[model samples]
Target chain A: MIAIERNLVTPRWQRVALPIVSLVMASIIAGIVLAVSGHDPIGTYQQIYAASFTADGALTATFIYATPLLFTGLGVAIAFRMHVWNIGGEGQLYMGAVGASGVGLLCGGWPLPILIVMMALGGALAGLAWALIPGLLRAYLRTNEILVSLMLNYVAGLFMYYLIYDSTSFWRDLTSSSALVFPQGKNLLPSSDWPGILLGSFTLPFGFVLGAVLAVLLLALFRFTRFGFEMRVMGDSPAAANYAGMRTRRTIVAVMALSGALAGLAGASQIGDFGHVLDPRGLEQAGYGYTGIVVAALAMYNPLAVVIVSILIGALTNAGFALQGPTFPIGLVGTMEGIILFSVLGGEFLGRYRIRFGRAPARAPGLDDEPGAEVAP
Target chain B: MNADLIVSIAVSAIAYGTPLVLAGLGELLAERSGVLNLGVEGMMLMGAVTAFFVSQTLGGPGLAVLVAAIIAAALAGAALALIHAFLSITVRVNQIVSGLALTIFAGTIGLSSYAGQVWGVGGQHGVHQLVKLDVLGLSDVPVVGPILLNQDAFVYFSWVLVALVTFYLFRTRFGLYLRAVGESPRSADAMGINVTRYRYVHTIIGGAFAGLGGAYFTLAIAPIWTDGLTAGDGWIAIALVIFAFWRPDLLVVGAYLFGALSSLGFTLQTHGVQLPSEFFSSLPYIMTVVVLAAASTTLARRRIGTPAALGVPYVREES
Candidate 1:
């Protein structure tokens, strides 16, 4: 019988090759599923490719989609580096939109640059506030942040819905003929609109540039800063960090806050650049917050790599929208995403272990006798 | 409140809570075996779609179709759980990541939706569904009658399952072995217990339970195939396991309580209680967070029934 054995040291080539191999495997599996469902996988993939890469204005559309993912991915990456599971990116992003909308409405008449800066600060602060509860709980009470953050997502969603759905709420769009028809907030003033760079016939939002700049800043912080080193050390081993004089609690809270701020900025960008209004439907449609988790994971929690992964995911999402039809459903993208993630996770096992087609390694015979026997301490 | 209204509310609560109870019990079993399967949501979705599809296509004697649906759902759930078991238990990947991946893969817009579309089952009602039945001559009795005796077969089945699980976990030798494996796999292994075998069995059994719960959604609750039919109920079930302190008895009570919270909006509105629906809608989630925070104290986690080796892959070598 074949026996799987853990490797003493994984090679560098294996580390790089496994992810790509997993992606290819995932695609093959997905293709088989599509083919079984009576759809042409090759044709579907070509359509996705054509819509995302070759179609007119598709590149610009992808950039728009990538903008929020970039910010959220960075947010997730930073928190993950500190071993904090901040699954509340969706909630934080929504709250950020709320904060940005509050600022945008009040300061709509202000100068363009000042209004933009105010909106960003408002969004960041709102996200920070939202994440603070779980962060503090995790730090002080040793609460599981994963569940807390996830639960908060539902709360944030409802809170946003309540605000926009209320007829008397200031954020509600009074311009609509019937408030009951669509529950959406007012559009931002012309001055608060995000300026875009003209490319051919398409305009790319300034948020993309902002995301690129923040990614570089994050990389620098992780590589050269004392705080980054402490966070990394704390993540690797909390006890060792504590013994070495690191303030673990403070680091946890600070890292979560920073992560929330980035997510909040993503939300603000969604409003200022694309939606231009606080619409619940728009927020749900732009699943950057949830997709950001996948992007972050695909990047292996590296802020720099998040940029490239976000764009790739952004393109896939655009393709999903483009390919929406009776036979070719939008859910194909979600399925592909799930398949890719599972494959990558499984691939990690292959990277760390090797399979030997032979009998088990000889050792002291016992119920657990097998290859890769551990040396007794 | 009038006795009749209270009884009716309680009845609805039981109906709503049945799925949660089933899913929670399954999750508790998995957690007890030191396997944290976050894929409950995805597995439930798969089960739901499978049951719906089977019931739709078969269109036969109501009882037979229901049985078939339940069996198909359990199989679907178990199949997904096997993937989780392999990744977390054998391959030794991060349990959380594996679970999350499974859920995303089989979630509302993933494999479930794909299946629904492929089978032409989307936006259709179940051909057969579980109906509420009054046990013996208890229909005319007071509050207890409707709340306890008048429920779908699944509700009664859940009660039995809970009782069985409670007994198995506390009173049986195998159950003791399973708990030992979860608490300290190394010691269990040293004692000649197959830790891996126990974990695999319990986890798959848990997945089967989750599948039954998912089938309840299409077979009883809504009786229709909708994308995201469970609507975060799986997540709530996961929380319910922790909230109940890993006890099957408490899990039933907690499930019913959250069930009441979930259906509170409809009940209140029907009784002419004027309040924003959002308040009631968010109640279950709010309570989940509160319960998590309350149980999060390090002392509580230790003193409470959380499995000691929960979320940790039990590699014999590492042990």
Candidate 2:
């Protein structure tokens, strides 16, 4: 019989190797599933790689996809590092888009640099405001942020849906000729659109640069700042932090707001750089906010690693679009992601414990015999 | 409101709330066993897709097909739950992370969607559905007839389940063991109770219940397969558990109240009320947040009866 035992101290090598082993195991499981479903697993994976990396314009497209995920992942990582689960990234993103659109649509004639800065601020503020409610509730009222944030996602989606669905709403595209068509908001003003940076033959949106910069900034913050130290201590043990006279409540709110701001920036970038519009349908389909959770998890809540993980996830998502067919459907990518996450979570055990195939170790005479031990047959 | 409108609303509320009741009860059971399974949404989705696929492909009598779909959904949900059980129970991973991973894996765009696409069940209206049944010709009795006596088999089954679950939790020996496991696993282990077995059984059963609820969406509510058809209903069910103070009796009331809130938009529209549809659509989610906030107060949580060891993974130490 196989017996699993817990190790008091796991080696550093085992900790690093487990995640990689889990990823490989996840891929194999995905391959088996694909094969069982009558598709060539190797061909499917090759197609994913080829389309994501080798195909023309694929890298640029991947960057575009990665941009939003990068911001959201960073947001999630920051909050998670402080032991806060801000599941409201999607909601905050929508609010940020709303804020950015408000500025973009109303002040179209503004100068390029000023407009971009204002839009970024607007988006960040909106996200911060959205996150504030749960943050406050969590800090003061002792509410669970996870449930509150999650519930807010649905509320935010409906809020956006109402804005576009209602004809009289300012966000709606009233000038469109056909009222019978599916309701969609107007695009951002041409002046509000983000310019791309030239890289050889490809034009990468400025959002990518912004995301990368933010990642570096966050890494610096975590490493060198007093606030970051406070966050880390508070996250490790709130009671202990309080005992040490740290302002835990303030840190909680600050961490959550910062997280929300990043997510909001992602939302703003999505509209300003890629979609160039505030369409609810497009926003709903993007799901960068949810995908951010996976990115943060895969990166182990490290702000620096989120950049790399986001790009990989972005590539997978981009490849998913290209792989959609009778045999290799869009959902296959989701399945693979789900498998990978499960494997990683399961692998956490192996990193901490060891499995043995032998009889149970003999129990110490006095310790093994409890007062009520005779009750068992 | 007029008698006819009231009756109609009541009927619709029952239909809408049936799934919540099923899922909420399942979560209640799992939490009672000290296993906080956050994968209800994922389990529900898997169940929805599995049931839809089974009903679509198996050509047979409607009743048989419905039963088959329910079974298939339960199996699917159990499979997902098994992964969660393995991770949280055996692997000793953080329960929240495990549950979150499972949900992502089984959510609308994940395993459920993959299965739906592979089975070619997406976009197809259900061929077999759980039709409303009138008991003892009592459906003709106005007011109460359509509201009570004329619900589908799923609703009736859910009612019976509530009773059984309530009894099992408070009256039965296994129920006592399960509760003991949730309250204090260490003590339960000392008492010769298998804490792991209790948690696993309850969590898997909880998953099965969530799957049954998912099947209710396709088989009774819409009779069609759509991506994310449940639309966060599973989350609402989780909130309902907290609102009910983890009691089966209160769960029914909370579920029905949420059900009424969900169906309010359609009911008002049908009656020519000029309220914004979004208001009604967002009410359930908004209320879930409110209820969770209200229930999560330190005093309330203690008084309202959350499982003592809930969400904490138990690891037995060698003596």
Candidate 3:
């Protein structure tokens, strides 16, 4: 039998080697899938690479998908670090979109800088409120947050449908006959549109800049704060945290709120940076919230790694979008994301244990007969 | 407001709820063996898409084709679950993440959709739809007959499965070993139960059940193929297992209860009830959260039924 025993200290070489190996393995598996399904794996991959990077405006388009993913990835990474399992990022993002769009609509006459700040805050606060439901339940009532948070996502998605298709709410475009018939969200004024920094060829979004800053802030928060210390203790062992008189309950709520706020910021970015309107179908189709979890997992729940991972995943998503047709299927991105996660998740074992191949060790000395020893006829 | 409306809803409830019963029972078996597979949705989709494809391509007698399709679906789901089993059990990875990976790999946007596109199964009507059984002419009887007796063979099989599983779980020694493995794997191992074997077998069996559930979508309920056609029913099925407290007998109750909530939107609308369609659509999801919260609260008080070793990878040797 094979045995795995936990190592007191993980080897540094193993830590660095595992992720690279995992990615290579995932690519090979995806290649096999392409080959089996009547496609040239190498050619298809080269095409994806070209669409995502080499083609003109591809990098700029990648940034569009990357911006929200960066925000949501950080959001998910923070929550996962605490083992909170806040899978409600999808719902929280929708609520954030609602909050940000509401703010943007009402504050259209305000200056761009002020309007953007209010919209971001509004989105963050709304997401926090939405996340607090499962957060409070998990902390106080001991409800399973995974299912609760996931259920809320369905509810939130339906709510978005209600806002756009069913009701003539403020967000609905009632003024335009074409929009009224189609039932789309009202557009924000051009003043509310976020500006981007023009690079030599690629344009960098304001939201992506904000996410980078947030990543640094989050790193600092974890590394240099008493709250972070308490949170770490609580996450590792809640019972120990309780015994130590740390506010584990408050930390639970705070972490969830922070996570939800990050997802909300993604929603705010969706509105301010790209969509400029509450496009329900478009937002739902993007599924950036779910993809964010993939980013967070691939990054090993580290906020800084999340920045780089988000761009890489964002490029894949853009390639999927750009190449969607008879030749390229839309499902490839999700399948690759899943495969990547599976590889990384399995590779997590390298850091945790050392496997020994041998016969089972001789049993430790015992009574030799267990209690309730078998009595047979 | 009449017997006809009530009867119609009741019939549809059982019809719609059959998939959940199939899937939830599978999840219950897995959870009872200490494997919390969150990939039921993905497994179900694989089953659904594979079953549809087989039913379309395979040439045989109608019944034989469907049976073959069902088997193919089960194998597809089990194939995915094997990955999950190997990862969570052997690799000692986090089960939650492992299951989510399976979902992402085989889910609506993943392999299932890819397979659907590759097979070109979309926009084609199911030629081999599940026919409702007359059930010894008892289907012609009063309201109970239509509600209970008029269900197809798939629904009846689910009932038999529920009964068989209930007996196997409670009465059989093997079931006892399975429960022991989940409750306390260390103790079970000490008791000479093969914890690894039981967990692997049961988790894969659970995936098979999820496959049957997904097959129901194409063969029986909707009679069509579409990406994410199961919607969020698999998630609801996962929640139903909690509502059942991991008992097979109670799983049927929870499934049909949610089934009624699922059919409510369409049933009531058909009966001319005026309400926002989305509100009706969200009922099952909302109710799942409510019931799960309630179940969790009750569980916290009772402190029973949950397998102690759930989501924890068992290692015989110490660090």
Candidate 4:
């Protein structure tokens, strides 16, 4: 019989080693899935790598996907860090786009810097409002935020369709005959487009820079702030927080709003940085909010790690779009992301416990046999 | 609406509600056994794709072909659930995350879409569809005749399955042990119940039920293939299980209620009840949110119906 023994302190080597093992394990699983579908796994991987990292315009394309992911990842990271499951990142992001696009359209003739700032705020506020529905309900009414937030994604998705496809909302472009024929959102003026930071050949999207800045602020917030201390303590042990008389409900609403704002940035970025028009199909298909969950999980909810992981996951998504075909289907991207998450969860489990092979020790060992054991001091 | 129109709407409501019943019943069993499998959507999609593929390729008599398709779909869903069972039960991954991962892995834009493409079934018309039945040949009778007597075989099967689950949960000795395991695994384990086995079996079976629900979508509803043909029925079904108070008898009622809501948009639009199609399309989801909030408030006060150990992994040594 095999028995799992708990690890008191995770050995330093295992932290680095387990991730590598998980990657290798995930690759094998992904390869098997690809092979079973009659696709060349090695070729697919190499193609994805080349398209995402090495092709001439590939890095730029990757940043296009990565921009929204960064915001959504940070949004999800904040809520998840505080043990608040805000899976409504997708909906929040859509609302964010609606929010930002509305602002850009309203004041497209404004000065460039001011227009960008207003749009960002508009997006963030929209996303925050959307997320607060679940957040407030969770805090006050004790509803399951998971179900509420997740369900709202569909509602938000439908709302976007309504604005563009069904209703003659302000967002819908009904002016020119061509615009009416296509049934699209009014395009933002050229001045509303946010400028990117250029580094020689590749340009860093303005949103990515904002997300990176937020990451530092987030890191500092946790490392230095009293609020962060309370948040972390509350996340780690709610009972302890209750004993300390912390306002649990307030934190839930605040963090939920904050997380939603972050996702809203993603939507704002989509309008300000790239689309300039609210393209529901484009925004919906990318699924940045959902992928952000994967990024946050892979980064272990660390803001700094979220930055690097977003790029990595972004590259994978970029590769998926590049390699879309009858054989290399779009579904493979989500499938691979799921496998990566599964292996990570499994790897974390493996890291925590030592599995002993062969017959069990016939005797129930006393607590003293272990060093610095889990028992209270 | 006229009597004829009302009767047709009720018939469509039953048709739409059948899948919800199947998926809700499956989730009820899993949640009852202390395992909340949120991968119902993913499982349902996998079941749908696989069932569609089999129905197209099997090349047999209609009855045999449908049976094969359904079995394949159940196995596909169960196969996916085994992953969640192992992750949540043995590996001790967070149940919520595990279920979400399962959905992501097999969702519309995931393995199901990949499989549909690989099997050459995407955008193809179904070769065979599940036929509607007229029970007792009562076709000419009014109102109840069409509503009760007319439905696809799967709709009737869903009712039977609900009754079976109700009996299994309330009337049997094993049923008592199952609830005990869900309520307090430590106590159940102390009393010599194999908690692990019970969770694994029920979760897998629950996945099979979700599979059958997905099969209903491709086999009857549209008889055409598309990514996410079930739309958000799987998610709505999850809410159905919750608002039903985890009771199988109540689940049927809730399923039909949502079914009516789901069909409302389509029915109304056909009868010149002008509204945004999206509003009609979104009713079930909006209703789910409203009902779930209501359920949460009521359940919070009473703290009844929900299993004590739901979403918690049972590790014997830790206990």
Kept native contacts, as fractions per model, are 0.55, 0.58, 0.65, 0.70
Q: Over the stretch B141-216, how does candidate 4's per-residue lDDT look in tens digits?
A: 8998889887778888888898899999999989999999899998999999999999999999999999999999
Q: Write the per-residue lDDT of candidate 3 for residues A204-270, one digit (tens) a residue.
A: 9999999999999999998899988887777667777889999888999999999999999999999
Q: How does each model score on lDDT?
A: 0.85, 0.85, 0.89, 0.88
* Model 1 backbone overlap count: 0
Which parts of model 4 are misplaced by more than 4 Å?
A1-4, A11-17, A355-377
Give the winner by TM-score: 2 or 3: 3
Q: What TM-score against the true fold does each predicted structure earn?
A: 0.94, 0.94, 0.96, 0.96
Sorted on lDDT, best first, the list reads 3, 4, 2, 1
TM-score of the first chain of model 2: 0.88
Proportion of the native interface contacts kept in model 4 = 0.70
Instruction: Give lDDT tens digits, candidate 2, residues A282-326.
Output: 788778888888888777777877888888899888888766677
**How far out, in Å, is residue B134 in model 2?**
1.3
| True-structure lDDT of candidate 4 | 0.88
Query: Which residue runs of candidate 3 sit more than 4 Å off their true CA positions?
Result: A1-5, A12-14, A355-377
Q: For model 3, how does the per-residue alpha-carbon lDDT over B1-319 read when each residue is reduced to its tens digit?
A: 8999889888888988999999999999999999999999999999999999999999989999999999999999889889999998888787888888898888877899899999999888999988999998899899988988888888999899999999999999999999999999989999999999999999999999999999999999877899888888888899888888889878898888888888999999888889999999999988888887888777646856788888888877432
Candidate 4 structure quality by residue, lDDT tens digits, A1-377: 88877776779787667656766787899999999889999998899899998998899889988889888999888898888889999999999999999999999799998998999999999999999999998998888898899889989999999999888888988997888568899899887889988877888899899989999898888789987887897777777888999999999999999999999999999999999999899988999999998888787777888898899899999998998997579999989988988998898787777889998656566653543222211
Error of 2 at A169 (Å): 2.3
List of clashing residue pairs for candidate 2: none
lDDT of 1 by residue, A32-62 (tens): 9899889999998888778877888888888
**DockQ of candidate 4 against the true complex:** 0.59
DockQ of 1: 0.51
